[model samples]
Target: MENEKHHIVPYRVYAIVLLVLVVLTFLSIAITDIELGSYTVVGALLLASIKSSLVLTYFMHLKFDQPYIRIMVGFVLAVFIAVVIVTFFDYSFR
Candidate 1:
C-alpha cells in the first residue's frame, strides 16, 4: 500500500459531468410529456442507465480505479442488465 498512486481529478471534469447529468434529467422529465406508450418506459430507463454510469465512473472514482475493479463493475452491470432483460421478456411474452 505504500507505493499506491493517488489521482487528482480536475474540478472541470466534475463540473462537466454534473452539467450533463442535469441535462439528461431534464430530458427524461420532458420525455414523459410525449405519448410514446410502450417505448416511454424504455426511454426513461435508457437515460437513467446513462446517468448512473456517469455517476459511477466519475463521482465514484471508478474511472481511476485499477483494471480489476473496473472489470468487476462491468461484470456486475452485465448481470444486472441480463436479469432486467429476462424479466422484461418473461412479462412481455405473457
Candidate 2:
C-alpha cells in the first residue's frame, strides 16, 4: 500500500527499553532473595508482566501495528489473564 508508511522506532528507545528490562531482571532476583511473605510472587510476576509487555510492544512491534492487531492482542491477553486467574483461584482454594 503506497499510503502506508514504514514505522521507524529510534535506537534510543530500544536502548532504554533494554536497560529497563535489565533493571527489572535484577529486581526480580532481588524479589526472590527478599522475605516478602505472600507478596513476593505478586511483585515478581508484576515485574515479569511489565517486562514481557515491553518486549511485546517494542520488540514485537505491536505498537506500530494497525488498531485491529492491537485489539486482537488485547483479546488474547484478556483470555490469558482470565485463565491465570482461574488457575490461581483453584490452587489457592485447594
Candidate 3:
C-alpha cells in the first residue's frame, strides 16, 4: 500500500486567521450598540459565518481536502439550516 501525504498548515496563515478572528470578535461587540435595525443581526451572522468558515477551512483543514468531505459538510450545514428555519416558523406561528 502506498502512503498518502497530507498538506501541512503554515504558521503565518494560522496567525493571520487568529488575528482576523480577534478583530471579528471585537467588531461584533462594538457593532451591537450601533442600532442598525435588521442589518445588525445580518452583519453579525455574516461575520459569524466568516469566522466559522475560517475555522472549518483552516483549523479543520477542510481547505486542502477531498470533495466527499465538502459534500458531507454541506449536507450537515443544510440540515442545520433547515432545522433553524423550521424552528423559526414554529415560533413565529405562536
Supply the TM-score for candidate 3. 0.82
Off by over 4 Å in 2: 1-3
Selected candidate, larger lDDT, 1 vs 3: 1
Q: Against the true structure, whose lDDT is highest?
A: 1
* Residue 17 displacement in candidate 3 (angstroms): 0.7
- Residue-wise lDDT of candidate 3 within 3-44, one digit each (tens)? 656787789999999999999999989889899985797688
Task: Output the TM-score of candidate 2.
Answer: 0.92
All candidates in order of lDDT, best leading: 1, 2, 3
**Model 1, TM vs. native:** 0.93
Question: Stretches of candidate 3 above 4 Å error?
Answer: 89-94
Model 1 C-alpha lDDT per residue in residues 1-94, reported as the tens digit of each score: 7788988999999999999999999999999999999899999999999999999999999988889999999999999999999999999999
**lDDT tens per residue, model 2, 60-90:** 9998889999999999999998998898899
User: In model 3, what is the error at residue 20, expressed in angstroms?
Assistant: 0.7
- State every prediction's TM-score relative to the real structure: 0.93, 0.92, 0.82
Clashes of each: 0, 0, 0
lDDT against the true structure, per candidate, is 0.96, 0.93, 0.87
